[model samples]
Target: MPSQKLSTLEKVGFGAGDMALNVVISSMMLLITFFYTDIYGLKTTDLALLFVLVKVVGAIADLVMGQLTDRYTSKGGRYRPYLLWLAVPYGISVFFVFTTPDWQYSAKLIWAYSTYILMTVMTAGVGIPYISLVSALTNDPKERLSANGYRLFFAKIGAFMVTIIVPILAQKWGDGNPAVGYQAAMAVMAAMGIGLFLFCNFTTTERVVHVVEKQSLLAQLKVLLRNDQWLILCGVCVTGTVGYVVRGSVAIYYAKYYLGGDTETVAAFLSTGVIAAILSMVASTWITKFYCKVKLFRYTQIAVAAISAVIYFTVKPGDMALAFILYFLLSFVVDLHAPVFWSAIAETIDYGQVKTGKRVSGFAFGGISVCQKAGMAVAGGLVGILLSYFNYQPNLEQTQFALTGIALMFSVIPGFFHLVMGMLMFKYRISDDYYTEVKVQMRDSGYIAG
Candidate 1:
């Protein structure tokens, strides 16, 4: 049997994968919409279309990559090899997306679609495998949770770097051209992404191997459809992602327009939330040791909804101090569920296998990825539509209508989705105790080593 506990190096190595992924994930969530309109000169409507279409392609790519992982194995194991082979291509794709050409609107739109699609496909190639690595790393649920805590902490560190460094780099490097600055900044981020992926590939090992059965896609889908617990988790993923993406996509806009901040204020505002989220990862790991993770997941999200309502009502435009304080609180509370949620996905796969008499590992993770993309599509389209409806013109002094829309998007709108996410968790029955029971059954049945 493989060892259950991982060393700090492996944990940090595993986390570095997420930190790499956030080069694109964080940018898509936090900067893409702003980049497209304010920097790349796309209309809100075009931006909306681009976001939805790109994620649609990404969703399909996720499933394909999942199947590839299931079918292929190498000396490095099932998932880690992808990090080594594709890291350079992934970095190159990210760089190209930020590269704005001096072309007409029609040609530029085509460039946008091509580069964004390429980036999304590369993201799927690495992302699916990276997330699935947790299962192969260990059978112990506690260790998975701990590793995920490190993963999320580093993931937030990536976001912190983006919020703090990207703006400064862009401003200083662009000299007078914001577009040139953004391109240069993102190129640096992309190179860091390549290095992190290589580090993750070299330092991590897949020890707990599952014998993934060869099955047709349709057969796997049927088995997955029967997993009620997995289904519930999928629902939770969608709602939670919608909340995260919507709020995240609007944050820079919120700081710039509603809060009336310049580049410095925007960076500070975004950094506040990310720093709070980083603390949430640490606090969550410690809290789950004493508190029930499930109850914590459910309650914290509900509390976030209340906090969101408070922020919307209490903080007026230009209330920077109050906005920062409330935003920090909301960011911290909302993410308390993240590590629990990710670790739960692997548990759900085990639950499904024991219940359905088959193991569907890759596709299960892929399905979750698909759900995430769906949420992003919804959130992206919504942000574009709302901005257009609010008559938001880029880099312009805001109208009252535009300011209110930004505030609502940043707080109440996303809060409602999070409230729904918390309610959905009520249906998720997996707990540490319950998962222990699952392991006992799997062990006795000879599916895994005890």
Candidate 2:
């Protein structure tokens, strides 16, 4: 069996990986839509197509990367090597995604597609292995949960940087050119991401190595499909991600237009949300110590839906203080599920191994990744379509219809998804006690090596 304890350093290192990954993730969630419209000048319809196609490509890449991880291992371990191998390319891809070329409109669209696809591919290159690393690091469910708390806490720190730093830096750097500012600012974040990945690789060690059975892709899928709990988590990933991306993608617009904010106010508003999420990480870690994580996950999301409705109905346009307060509360409760959700992935994988007698590690993680991407795809398309429907115009004073649409995207529409997410968790039954039983079974079955 894998060691149940991880040192603080190692936990921080593991956390750093997500922090690094969040450079891309947070940007995708928070800024990509805005950047495409305002900075890079892509039409909303073009953006819709691009988001859908790129995520489709990303889902495929996730699957391919999954298989590759299963087939490959080295002295640095199965998953950590990817951090070393792909760090530079990953950084470069992030830079390219934000780069604006002064080309023809069609050329710009092509560049957008090319760079975005490249970024997603590179993201899979590191992301699949990075997530799979959590299982490799420990077999203890509680340890996994604690480590995930660290991971998410740092992830939000990365997101906080994106929300607080990116806009400010872009505004300063671009100096009259927002595109140049975004490019320069993102280059710095990309570099930090590369460094953080390397730190994660160096500081963390994989102790729990699964004796994964060599199987065909179809066979692996069959095995994964049999895990009902895994399926539930898949649903959770999709719906939660859709809720997250939809709200996040619209936050800047909400802040700038609905709240009538300038650049600083916009940054503060987005920062408020990220800071609340950051605090939620700590709160979740502490709260789960005293309560049922599964229950917490279910209730917090439902609360999010309720609070979101309050925001929609109660907060009027330009009601900045009330908006910030409600949004902070909404953001806080909405993310309380994060640590539980990520840690539960490994638990479900363990449950799957115990149930199916087949250890489907890499592909299972990949499947979760794919679900997240699918959610992003759906959310991105929704944002684009909704923007078009509402006649959203970039850098222009929005029509009342468009402003209301932005408000709904930020609050009610995404909140409905969170409601679905919470209800789906009623089907998830993997408690800490149940996971302990799973561990005992795996140990007895000799599926896990001591």
Candidate 3:
């Protein structure tokens, strides 16, 4: 079971596609809730519920796509075909995601719900299998680490650039009106979606194949669920996933309420946060090599929590400058953990195999994907429902209570989740030694590697 070979170009291509996917999808989530509440006239509760429903759909898509891609066999490999077939649909849904309409609120809700759900479902279908394919592409653990590091690096760039420019797109597209900004953001988002699809099409290729292609979904799930390592990692994955969601969802209100900044300034603040997040990629790359991925994850997340604590108490009106800097630091923590999480996933794949005496990377990671989305859906829904609970008014300034909630959302909620994830990571057993040992055993046991 010596490693199968491929040209270096193929490796770069696959990694590039992963970067493209992360950037566009994450940026859309980062911005879309604001779009619904402000630009598109969707109520907070409605939009949140819509996203929750979409998350459910997306989860199913991941599970099904996992099974399909596991069985996938094409010249391009199991993953490439989905990247090809789903490309158009991915772009099309995203285009419509931001598109505005003349329809009534009910009609608009229908349209928005359908489109968002479609985007999430299609995205998960493409994304999970694509991600799971990483191990198959190269069994060299460090190469997988390098692949994830490179992908996260570009993803931050994409996220940073998107954050910086998205509001500008909104302004230019919306022509100074929130309503128009909604329409314009959708168009821009759609364009990014196309870029994502085409980039993957041109850049990536799968190397190794899923030999257990005929394994039934039930069989896969049973084994996947039985793996203790997968269960342990899921804790960190789900908690941290909620940490990201709460921070992202609350940013709009944090800027609007805590800093009392105008929309443009808030967007700028977020752009700055993205800048901080970008730098974390480099830091994470080196940190992963020296410290255990799980350990670094705990340290960084705790650091994020500490930063959030600073913001929660220190933020004051007319202190916008100070708050922005505080958030930039918090964003650094957010960015720092980005690579740690993915690399952790790669390790968990090995962890699962070693523990179960079977390999089901697709199912294990797919389950994690589902957990992440579920956390997000819950957090986003809670954010929305809570925004409405506190009587958040988009057109006007928030009430004192609403403002408190916003601050807490960004500070306490995410802070708490990060702490929980840290504790969870402590229980995780995967180490570089464990991962390398697992790989040695697998390769010896006739597992194919490319």
TM-score of each: 0.99, 0.99, 0.93
- In candidate 2, list every pair of residues with a backbone clash: 1-449, 1-450, 174-181
Which candidate number maximizes lDDT? Answer: 2
- Tens-digit lDDT track of model 3 for 299-371: 8787878888888888875578888888888887766766657767767766666666667766777788889
* TM-score of candidate 3 versus the correct structure, residues matched by position: 0.93
Query: Could you give me the TM-score of model 2 versus the true structure?
Result: 0.99
Cα-based RMSD of candidate 3: 2.2
Q: What would the per-residue lDDT of candidate 2 be over residues 1-450, giving only the tens digit for each residue?
A: 654799999999999999999999999999999999999999999999999999999999999999999998999999999999999999999999999999999999999999999999999999999999999888878889999999999999999999889999999999999999999999999999999999999999998888899999999999999999999999999999999999999999999999999999999999999999999999999999999999999999999999999999999999999999999899899999999999999899889999999999889999999999999999999999999999999999999999999999999999999999999999999999988999999999999874
Q: Candidate 1 lDDT, tens digit per residue, 76-154?
A: 9999999999999999999999999999999999999999999999999999999999999999899999999999999
Return whichever of 1 and 3 wins on TM-score.
Answer: 1
Model 1 C-alpha RMSD to native = 1.0
State the lDDT at 269 in candidate 3.
83
